[model samples]
Target: MLIGQYFQEKILSSVKCTDKGSAYAKFEWLFGKGLVTSNGQLWKDDRKLLGPSFKLQKLTGFLPYFNKHSKTLVEILTKFQHQATNVYPQLVRATMDFISESAFVQDSTYQINDEDNFLAATHMALTSFRLRLAKPWLAITPKIWDLFGLGKQDKICSQFVNQAMSEAIEKRKIALAQEQKSSSETGENHANQKAFIDVLLDSKSEKEIIGHIMTIFGAAFETTASAMNYTLFLLALNPSAQEKVHFELDSIFGGDKNRDVTLNDLSGMKYLEMCIKEALRVCPPVPVMVRKAQEDIPLDNGQIVPKGCRVVILIREILRDQEHYPDPEVFNPDRFLPDECAARHPFAYIPFAAGQRNCLGMKYALMQMKTCLAHILRRFHVSTSQKRDDISLINGMVMEPKPKLEIVLTPK
Candidate 1:
């Protein structure tokens, strides 16, 4: 790739990301001027405005929602026990419902497998965007894809997403207005119990509110679902690893399949956390991250990434590099033990990226992953017919296992 001597120094923390780049613009079709796609002052302001919602304390408030949905997911998947079933769709539905409740304070019926909902339209839009990004020439002038009818369905998907989100935003606005009026009349403020949508409504326009809601929905649901899918897939193929995970879950839950996963419980899941990290290392949700160079970056080998150049940080490649991770292809959770991780390059494992511009919802996503796995692994033993090397992968905003991941779950 580069001068071998400078390999370790190239990815240092000093290189700042300029912008999110063009691939993310496809998201603007639905998330108009929202957090993930914006840059400069707009992005900074939006990040500050929304940062507190994802803070650890606030995320604890979402545990009940995550646990409730995780139970629903387990119940639904119970119907498929002992049979090879693709759990990806069910995972997506569960996460979508969870996000809907957390972000909008509304219960989405998608968990009931209703495929005609707005959340379903969001899934369609993401597929279209991924397709658009695949064709470099066509994506350069995105409207050309529309001309070839490739974007017709995407257009319809966008319409569905926008219409649905807009209506939700309007309803939230009316509800907030009424609540505020009543609060003023009664001289009692309910500021302590405001929902995320309520906070966004105070500062953002209707379109911007819808945009950020979609941004959170699009990013959170799919990526978390993919991460969980890969984690389960890896555990299925490795019986020993699955047994270890079960051991940890059993030790923690103590036969309480329905117990709520507390912050302390999640913190104590050292080995399960390792398995999750290794899964992310082997198959990061977003494999390649793009950043525009704001300033020229000098390499130890004398090459310079000139200012304004588009820099592609291959996250999957980095995680797989043998120099950083010995026996990189292996699914060994032992590699993430504290001392082992401390010995490696800090940048070796960045499933969520690094620096100031990293994922804002990092804590929230991790909590969901840990909580959902706690619920499922405690109640069932997972098994599969696929091998790690034989699994097919597709490139999108998130990496997906192709041919669908079919696995069987047996009650513990």
Candidate 2:
């Protein structure tokens, strides 16, 4: 087993680039050739330019959007009380709206009932990519996918997303210019809203702005939905854990389901955080991520990963290693306790990955999960007819629970 000598040394931090240039090539069609796809100086420059926007203080500004959208999710879940239903779409839409509000400073209007073609195109494009991933020949040759009509549909979807993003970028640029003029004339800097768009708008070109914004938007939702989905699934299967989460919420908010989740509330949610962490450990949204060795890299055990070799790290497996987590298969949040975590290797649990090229929106994603779950558990009791063994997860960029997730929620 490549366990003891390999991972314990934390060699992943040595990785400088993802295999996004190849593995996520199809994604570049929709997301533009941005940071996620670029490498070396381009990736470094983009990372440098966009880093501050995801800082803790900056992410705090996005809390209101998370809180606002979580309420909508709670309302939707309440409507489906006592019924076994798939809640993933609602979670995706909530995050979609949250991203819209936080990044575009407006609504994308991607409601459950709306015929948003852009959203449909996004779904189709991802499905096409997933299909091609399973059948590598289709992806290996662009003509093969186009011959089967998959590539055309993917392009159309990419165009739709790009067009929408382009329009949004233009509008923001004009509005920002006007705001600057107004401020200059008034001799007062009254910029009321801070958003991801503000950071993207600072980029040198419109294409650069679109690329960065789409990169942020592209990375935001599906991963978050997966995290939320598995988190809810784990909590539902383990009622003892669910009850503890409820108790924590009740104590914090005084049983007020409608209460706003402040940053302070999230900090106080120590146990809920553990539950989320443990859930991610077992069913990491991005189960496997590929990194290419830039140079000859030596492992702690006198082994070397030659340059240009592809390294795939199994995040889910490592998190469940018996050596690190006793009773590895169990859904025990206590395993993530501070003392317990400190005792383990630093790289034992990396849901968002690690090092210089880790997920940029990690802090943002965690806040969204905590805020949304806080609202959800406080307002409703979650249970599912589906057992743990019933979960059939498919490997995409994220681990998607197959068929559908049928959870029953009862309003508290």
Candidate 3:
């Protein structure tokens, strides 16, 4: 296992080091040959082609979708106010809604309303994936496993999700073709406001597009939802920290809690951003990431990582290192203040990993998170009796609080 910022910078920044680890391969069944599971030239080509869709300026176009879904989330949560409610599932569905509109240009209210079974299928597939990872004996060849009916349910769920995404991709391709014909006739251009699927359709085959869409959507929604839930959990445990977030939100929206969050409003949310950053540091969505060493790489400790070694980056340990963060267990958003952040090593706190293969949707995730939190905090006072020690986290695909995250939401 690789610990410390020096290794993080050296290995993650290396040109030859690829994310073709065993853990990543486990995702191939669900994510296919998407960016997350891809390596080498294919990964590079996909990253470059998809890069423009997530640019900071282009992200501004997604704020409306973020705000709309966040409002829906507020309405949904209001029903459970004054009672301890497990909000993680709701947050995940809301984020699914956000990604559906922003990335795929489709309405996912059916999933949110439980009319569609996509979310349940996804959860089943992920649970089975984790189980298979834990018990290697259960990870037999697909044909043998199916013949024995060992992973029948998981296989069905995986097929359901893949089919759903495939259909969505095909539908979008046809719509894009018609839109292009209309635009050509009218001398109009909308290259600047293209959705993520639209961009992929321009340069990818249908099968390839399905893989990219599933990969991007899965990565974006699940991690963002986990991060948001963890932040809310921490804020609920620490009222003062929660109040600081409320104060910052009040300063920005000020008596108009129902107003949509503007780009300027998002930029001005310094303290809220700090709280989110601190939450990420405490309980990152992905606590561990694995990258395979393509070639022998030397470390500052005078040891060389052998070629083809599976190097594990312990992100949770690195973020909580005493050398970098004092009183690391404390929930202090001020730890992320400007001066303190400046003094820390660049790789000391990589919630989204770092270097070339870092998360492409980092900016988009943060914006969606901040906007959602702003909407919720502005209208609701979230509190929970669950203590930090009582919560057990499952460090699987995404770090999830086991037994669900139950919290009370009272009107502000």
In terms of lDDT, the poorest run of 10 residues in model 1 is: 1-10
Pairs that collide in candidate 2 are none
> Quick one: best lDDT, which candidate?
3
Q: Which stretches of candidate 1 lie over 4 Å from their true place?
A: 1-16, 113-115, 140-143, 174-194
TM-score of 2: 0.93
Query: What is the C-alpha lDDT profile of model 2 across 1-412, one tens digit per residue?
Result: 1333245335466644344436767677666667777777778787887777778888777788888888878887777889987888888888888887788766556655468776787688668757867888887778887899887888788678778877787777787788889889989763435577787665557777777776776677888887898899889899999999999999999978787889899999999999998888888888777677677777666877777776777777777788888888899999888898898777777788777678888888888899999999988888888887887878876788877778888888
TM-score for each candidate, following the candidate numbering:
0.91, 0.93, 0.95
Best by TM-score: 3
**Which lDDT tens digits does candidate 1 get at residues 43-102?**
888988888787777778788888889999999989999998889989998888788877
> Taking the tens digit of each residue's C-alpha lDDT, what string does model 3 give over 1-412?
5656668899889876875677677667777889889998888988899888899888888888999999999998888999998888888888888988888777768335775767778777667767776765666677755665756886788778878878888778888889899999999987777899888776888778777877877788888988899888899999998888888888888868899999999999998999999999999998988888888988889999888888788898899998988889998899889999999898998999888789899999999999999999999988998888888877877887877888899998
Q: CA lDDT, every prediction?
A: 0.81, 0.78, 0.85
Q: What is the lDDT of candidate 1?
A: 0.81
Which residue runs of candidate 3 sit more than 4 Å off their true CA positions? 147-151, 185-187
TM match of model 3 to true structure: 0.95
